[model samples]
Target: MTTITLGRYLWERVYQIGVRTIFGVPGDFNLQPLDYIYHVDNLRWVGNQNELNAAYAADGYARIKGVPGVLVTTHGVGELSALNGVAGALSE
Candidate 1:
């Protein structure tokens, strides 16, 4: 059996659902996973200035494209910053 990283599993699941664009803010924690995740797939990475912006963009993309938009961020603070946009997306 082959081992698959969390990143690869996420990429595969999203890709299967027609999610080709990933919006994110790369940080030390997430950069490595970003590199490992997307390289194996034909996915486009859309870097944003901040985690909140990335989340908003991903949400918008999801609405426009009819597919789930992925937002990648680091743990704790980074993920917290995106909650507003994520919550908004969920409310709509």
Candidate 2:
């Protein structure tokens, strides 16, 4: 089998698992993985204005698509900002 970096491995796995669309706000820490994921065929990365919106969007996508939605964000504030939407999703 061809060798792949950890990022590529994750990207491929997500694709294999039928995750055709991902939503997130890009930042330095996560840019590499996002780039790799976006490059993969049949996979699309949906850009959001912020993490909270991304998480909410992902949740909506999951409900309609019957698959887990994913969101990537910057560390610290980015993650914190998503908590509200995440909580709402979890509570629903």
Candidate 3:
């Protein structure tokens, strides 16, 4: 029997959807998941200065690539910091 990890499963889905790059800030909480991302075939990780900037980068990538963009961030403050950028993406 083969065991598939949650991280691997998530990345597989992301890659299946045509997301070649993922943007985010690395955090203790996200380190394990990032490790999985590193091993995924054809998926690249783009580290950003902050969660807000990561969100903006994902939005721009989505606009240019015509595919849905993805951002990964830690819980609490990381998620909070990304709210403004997400709101901007939604409004524009």
* Best-matching candidate per lDDT: 3
Any runs in candidate 1 off by more than 4 Å, and if so which? 1-6
Each prediction's RMSD to truth: 1.8, 1.1, 1.1
What tens-digit string does per-residue lDDT give for candidate 1 at 1-92? 89888878878887889988999888888777788665556888889999899999999999999998789888768788899889989997
lDDT of each: 0.85, 0.86, 0.92
Least accurate stretch of 10 residues (summed lDDT) in model 1?
32-41
Model 2 regions more than 4 Å off: none
- Tens-place lDDT digits, model 3, residues 11-58: 999999999999998888889989998778889999999999999999
Residue pairs clashing, model 3:
none
Q: Order of all candidates by TM-score, from best down to worst?
A: 3, 2, 1
Ranking by lDDT: 3, 2, 1
User: Which window of 10 residues has the lowest lDDT sum in candidate 3?
Assistant: 72-81
How many backbone clashes can be found in candidate 1? 0
- Sequence-dependent TM-score of model 3: 0.93
Per-candidate TM equals 0.84, 0.92, 0.93
Q: Give the runs in model 3 whose Cα sits over 4 Å from its true position.
A: none
Clashes of each: 0, 0, 0
